[model samples]
Target: MSRAQPPIAVLVALSAVGPLALNMFVPSMPGLAATFAADYGTVQLTLSLYLIGLAVSQLAYGPLSDRFGRRPLMLAGIGLFLVGTLIALLAQSIGMLIVGRLVQAIGGCAGLVLSRAAVRDLFDRERSASVIATITMVMVVAPMVAPLIGGYLDQWFGWRANFWLVGAFAVVVLGFAVPLLHETNHYRQPLPGLSGMIGSYAILLRSPVYRAHIALIGFASGAFFAFLGAAPFVVIDLMGHPPSDYGRWFALGAAGYMAGNFASSRLAVRVGLCRLIQAGMGFMAAGAALMLTLALAGQMTLLALFGPMAMIAIGNGLVLPSGNAGALSVDRRRAGAASGLSGFMQMGLGAGISTLAGHLVVDSALPLAAIMAVSVAISLLAFHALRRANRQARELAARTRPALPKAA
Candidate 1:
């Protein structure tokens, strides 16, 4: 690892590309459907498939970056992002647009995976968690701000305007990244090939603590992705609200998430990861419960839809930084692989939930609310499992330790 750590701002910009591309174009989904004369399900593939691409590509990126170092892979990924964004901007058909999104996801995920690995390289567990928490706090701004820009761009210019802006943003981030980001991976382990990668992942999966952390990360994120998939359709198409209105309302959820991350950044080291995680999950569960109750009770206004989501966002913000730190800490030697696998689980579940929610939330937001509730429930169970596993390991260690000789 280079003694020089990259500035937090650079890391944020690098990481923000993925979320920016993901959220900025979301407000244009309805327009995309109208332009291509496709059904909503088909149009929704752009988001779901992009998520799947992020999931699958991270598997390779983590291991490859671990072996090759971070800077080069990150640059390559950003280059791919630029190319994909260009293709998307110029696409003539929905199929082409989906293809472009997949490419963008594959390339963009390089930054996401490497940035976390870089942090692990630079800091110990608690400190890394703190840093990641701070990074996420700032990074949340991208998704929160992106929708507003996306909505206005779509409304004022067209669907293509959003992609144009994304491309330009990527170019600027790329310019800064090339100069500032250096080799942060100081320890490079030998991964002979594909089998080595699989073996690394297997070792991580065998650990109950690691598995629990991944579960928490995956399902917690699933709640939000489900919302992203369904909310645009619910607000814009069904509720007959404009895209700008959807963007404005969506800011509430983003702000809540930012607040939660701010709390995590301050409290993670002091309060401990597990407590923070539990508290965050409590927020998530409550949010989902309230949302489902509202939907079942026939409260389908904008506040009813977005307000509970704000609560869920706060929970996610609290859980994610700690979850990532806990998982990466499991085997610091395999931090890259751990990061990759965790991201895979997170995005894979998200892709599935986003697609499912898009299909089910056609008539009402009840299905979306129900999905969030189930996801939050799973997250709570995962945190419980993590606590149990940690307790068992401690008990086993105590039993295994040799008895000390009595003092004379």
Candidate 2:
């Protein structure tokens, strides 16, 4: 209702900002190194430290949002982001640039965490999943376009221009979002003492349902990350394709992600979360299965690599949205906390998977294929376990129902 923007558009923009912040400057890395006369290892801290800051700040924002409302805290985060971007734009040394990036990450994460929490706040689980999928679909476009944009910006204006652009974007989004963002946390949980906060997290950690859902997301997406890590090697070395050809194939794989998101947005409301998850896992399993088959059979072709991965990408698109929404729904008062923790697991596990995939590719494409397949298989098992747990809990509740109606 605010004159700035609608809720959905705002969510889309908020979600998009995190990815843009994370990747938009990647193409500028070489230019950055040359500008500061630093080695690649030193310059890489700009990314690694940013990730560390991102992971840490997301954890803090969740519980803080529970105490405060989403709007003020998110606004504060934007303020921090803008301040950091300004610092980066003016940075005269590599250390200063790295510091700026770290601060930027601390604030940039607010959008990724809060937007998911806000979705749960505003909608039911299934609907939340559908909307989140839509937001995620839109957000993917940013990463796809970001590098190209960064490439041009670096060519035309140098690396500093990228930071300037990010700062401008922050200002624009802040102006647009201020009036539209409602405080969606209807139930203000009392500021927890340390012990109480620990107890809350303890309960969530103890939940088999929560753990299972988290694991499903962790490994399901892990397969995709594995593929991403291995793809360049497979395309350039194993399959004898050029880097540009890999880029084209990567775009096709990304299209598969878009396709899956489109399917989830259309079908999640109609078929429900469990069935949709099942279908997604099926796609993943089939894709992964084909990858292994090709590798084992010594085909080792580019089609074998990219074709099936596109399918896996599609599956992750479906699972990530639904799984994330469902995880947050299990703990309503702690949606912010839940979203943050789940995100941490997904990111942490994804990093691990990508690293392992890199190591596993030393010998042949077979190891990459094997690791990806195994990761998806693990996710399928976790999902089925969670589904079984849900059924058992429902049956137990039914059995415990009182017979007072007979007396009446």
Candidate 3:
């Protein structure tokens, strides 16, 4: 790490681009549809397509960072993101909006992947997890209140102003990142060619420990994405609340997420990663169960829906930082690649879950609750399997350790 390195707040700001972009724009979707004369599904494509672009681009940026160092590539990413944001700000049609958003996703992904990699680059695994937890807790505030700000922005300045805000934030981050960002990749490997990059991915895919962490995060995050996809329609469309109201409901859930991150930051090293993840899964299961019970009992009101969601958010905060560190731990030499791959998995699964949730087209909250429940339950199963695999690997390594022979 550089002596004059930037604070973790900078990293938090950088990593927050994805969610901030996503959440801030959500409140404006109805307005966007009205502006471009498009349908809800068409407008929603901006989010889904952006996530797809983000997933694919991060896969490449990780290795590129490993080869070129984090600073230059990150700056390039910020530049591209601004370009896309400008394009969207000036867009006159839905097609143009989606095109700009796709480009923007590819650009914004740089910060999201690199920020996590930067933490791993600078700190030990345990401390990295704690720092990540703290960063996430703070960064989450972006998504937490973004819709509120964005709602007012839409009402006052029009939807294009949301992109303007995104651009402004990126510019500020770039200013700081240039002056204070440090290079953490001490061992510079030559940038891999196509085949070499594939080989690197192959190696990560072969690690059971790495894959387990990926699976756990993928499903845990999927549940949240499913909610993000469905909530606008549920709250604004079905329940007939204004877009501004969704922001208030979302904050309650975000508070839960923030609480969990606080706990993870405080207890990650002492409680250990695996235990924290397990406890998080337990929280998820409990929340999902509560949601399911309410839905089945015909109590599928707004409180019934989002209240339980807060609990799941809490679990995600606990599991995600620990999971990211665990995945990177399995391949410290390739922390960039691991972080990218895991992020891709998280977003890719999120995209799929959200897409499905959209297509479900439910008149009630029961369907959404059911999907979230199932998703979290599956995440729990993945964690247990990972736990067992880790235990076996540890025992095998212990047995294979070289005997001390006779004391010299």
Best-performing candidate as measured by TM-score:
1
Can you give the lDDT of residue 260 in candidate 1?
90
Between which residue pairs do clashes occur in model 1?
A: 1-186
- Model 1, residue 266: distance off in Å is 0.5
Clashes of 2: 0
In model 2, residue pairs whose N, Cα or C atoms come closer than 3 Å (at least 3 residues apart or on different chains), thus clashing, are: none
1-408: candidate 3 lDDT, tens digit per residue? 435555787788778876788899887886676788888888888878887888888889989999998878787888898899999888989999899998888888988899888888888999999999999999999999998888778878888889999999999988888877777677877888889888888999998888889999999998898888888888888888877888878898899999999999999999899989988898899999998899889885779888899999999999999999899889888888888899899888888888777768568777888889889988988998899889988999999999888987
Residue lDDT tens for model 1, 328-396: 999998999999999999999999999999999878889999998999999889999999999998899
For candidate 1, which ten residues in a row score worst on lDDT?
1-10
RMSD of each: 1.2, 3.8, 1.5
Q: How well does candidate 1 match the true structure in TM-score terms?
A: 0.98
Model 2: what TM-score?
A: 0.84
Candidate 3: regions farther than 4 A off: 1-4
Model 1 score (lDDT): 0.92
lDDT of 2: 0.78
lDDT (Cα, 0-100) at 55 in candidate 3: 84
Candidate 1, which segments miss by more than 4 Å at Cα?
A: 402-408
Instruction: Single out the weakest 10-residue window by summed lDDT for candidate 2.
Output: 1-10
Model 1 clash tally, residue pairs: 1
Backbone atom clashes (below 3 Å) for every candidate: 1, 0, 0
